[model samples]
Target: MKPSLASNRRTDRYQSKTACITGIVAAIEDQASRPNAAERNRSAGPIV
Candidate 1:
């Protein structure tokens, strides 16, 4: 059976959002562990 277009779009949006959130969390964790905030921020880049 074929999937609906709306469902596909929703799934895509959810995946992208999840990825963005995950990246942000990782960046935060890195910042907490590392002393250099500047480097962590740079590594995080657009994710934060």
Candidate 2:
């Protein structure tokens, strides 16, 4: 069924905000661990 924009607006907005916050936190944590990472130059991040 096609979703109704009016009904989904609040839910979509909440999800978007939540996703942004989560992504930012994850990025910060990933960067924080960089100094100790054995291989910092890899695209996949520190190679354990």
**Highest-scoring model, lDDT:** 1
Tens-place lDDT per residue, model 1, 1-48, is: 234566787787777888899999997898788879867567887653
RMSD of each: 6.1, 6.7
- What lDDT score goes with residue 26 in model 2? 86
Q: Against the true structure, what is each candidate's TM-score?
A: 0.61, 0.56
User: Mind giving the per-residue lDDT tens digits that candidate 2 earns over 1-48?
Assistant: 334667677777777788899998987788787765435557566648
lDDT of each: 0.77, 0.71
Cα lDDT of candidate 1 equals: 0.77
